[model samples]
Target: MSDRRLDDSEMATWLPTIRFVQLLPQVLDRTLKAETGLKHSHYAILVTLAGQGDRAIPMTELAQIAGLSRSRLSHAIDSLEERGWVTRTSCSSDRRTLTAALTEAGRELLRTAAPVHVAQIRALILDPLTDAEREQLGAILAKLTPGVAAAL
Candidate 1:
């Protein structure tokens, strides 16, 4: 493979974009943990489960949707289960597979956290952008998602 380095124009775009990707999650995670006593990962899991309409999802599928490894998802679920926020049970048809379901407490927590989280997201990300810029950003990010997922 050729050891081609990024040109100056490419660097200009890539550096800031990569830095934002790295730093935004840390900032959001810290804020979420401080306000809700949950890390960003936990918040993501809860959000995903909440969106499933009270149905349980297989652990593997949950891990994929949550962008977590199976072990990490399992560990997080363990903590959530201990806190009465989530539950894990054997899948009815496949006894070997475990499914995770959000508990009522989890739903309550999510309801409480959603407003604050949405506000934070707006303040940190969307509020600064103009309507046109927001649309452009959505389009740009949509273009990028598939490649990033494939790389992963």
Candidate 2:
């Protein structure tokens, strides 16, 4: 624990940032679940896989990109596999190395799910911020992401 405590000025900035970080996932998860029967983490995993085009990502890399523990990602992958949305396979030469890819069903589900998720993001987050504020937030996050990723 640190010896220093947040002062009023610091808390003023930190409180809402913390709240946004904490609550945003819950809000997004609820909306996604209601509209698409998918949670935000699962959606994120899908998006990450989709973003890579035809490539099948190694499970370790997927876990890092999806910001999930290896076990959590394993469970999520199983759930996704059960829904016919993803596939996991082992390398022929190296059976211990596994990779994951999105199936056609996953792509089709994203076609329906993306709009709802994007709309909610705009409504709850982006639409409220001015262009300048959005720029600043983007820059701030970009600067902080390296340190945060290193910690993870």
lDDT of 2 by residue, 1-152 (tens): 89999999999999999999999999999999999999999999999999999899999999999888899999999999999999999967789999999999999999999999999989987899999998998899999888988898
- After superposing candidate 2 on the true structure, give the runs of residues whose Cα lies further than 4 Å from its correct spot: none
Give candidate 1's total backbone clashes: 0
CA lDDT of every candidate = 0.92, 0.94
Enumerate residue pairs that collide in model 2.
none
Error of 2 at 137 (Å): 0.7
TM-score of each: 0.96, 0.96
User: Tens-digit lDDT track for model 1 on 1-152?
Assistant: 77999999999999999999999889889988888888888999999999998799999999988888898999999999999999999999999999999999999999888887899999988999999999999999999988987775
Superposition TM-score, candidate 1 onto the true structure: 0.96
